[model samples]
Target: MTATQSGPRISTEDFRFAFRSHPAGVAIVTADAGDGPVAMTVSSVASVSIDPPTLMFSASAGSSSTPTIRSAETLVVHLLAADHVELAKLGARRGAERFGDDVHWGRLPTGEPFYPDANWLRGRVIRRLDVEGATIIVVEAVEARPRDDGMSVDPTPLAYHNRHWHVLTDRSMLPPAVAPFYAVYGRE
Candidate 1:
């Protein structure tokens, strides 16, 4: 939602309402410029201009990844797999020790670190739009799979709403289940 929304300075409730209104695909923005690695959960990530193969994501000023994200001119936006919720949470966390030998990490030709389990994308930061409330970062995709896991799009996407993480799976498409709340938020 646009900040101005055809009007003036909105109220705090308006912002909260806007944020809760939509279902957003959760993503973790990753960065590592020699001082270890860092990442954060951001729903603000989106494709800006396809002509130049560009995209962008915003990070809060108070984000622990602020310096790392701002310092590097590039980053790796890894779309999490179904089983990677823990990884997503780990990345979003602040001041946690990152990079375990158990988790996969690799380098691109340009020396960019990436995770293999990522739903496939390696991007480079292009420019930053210094807005009043947030930093609008623009990026260009350098490496990504045209078809991840041989699928045009993921069968399920990791989603977040109402302060909870959800697995939007194909099973959700099934007709009414025994659960009550399940009747409300239809699946798929």
Candidate 2:
């Protein structure tokens, strides 16, 4: 069933509010198209496929980094952990100095700027679709790099919901049923 089949048409504010209640993982996208580097925080990143390693994210026209990201051939998508909440805020803040002297970022051999501290995937822009005031970008992942800290465990992921940042941990997990699928499949 679609919203059009329902009683009334959804307003823009109502659409925004509905998504606000949904939790999304946070990511910082960085691109450098020969001029300089630009970064923006987004919660729109999602895995589209696993065979070819594809992902998609929407870049809003309102963001200052949108133009640079659109023009770049390749970009880095940094999946933020709870420890990098400050970096996420830096990318989300409008007009903030994203790559200052204090910021620890470096350019990849392929020429895209990236944060080495975060688990990131570098990908080539495969497709771009402009819809409304945002551009939906599809990328084919070429390489992925994990944090250099040598930690064997997964870091607590950062999330965005209702205009606030959140962290996802094992404690947040709900008790599973007696015969969980993962347990039956011999997975945790």
Q: Pick by lDDT: which candidate is best?
A: 2
* TM-score versus the correct structure, for each prediction: 0.76, 0.88
In model 1, the runs with Cα more than 4 Å from the true position are: 1-8, 145-155, 171-188
Residue-wise C-alpha lDDT for candidate 2, range 1-188, written one tens digit per residue: 86668778879999999998899999999999888999999999999999899999999999989999999899999989999999999999999989999999998888899998888999999999999899999999999884555633678999999999999988888677844889889898
lDDT of 1 by residue, 89-141 (tens): 77777776556676666666666666666665677787988776678888898
Off by over 4 Å in 2: 1-8, 146-152, 178-188
For this target, which candidate reaches the highest TM-score against the unseen true structure?
A: 2
lDDT of 2: 0.93
Poorest lDDT segment (10 consecutive residues) of candidate 2: 146-155
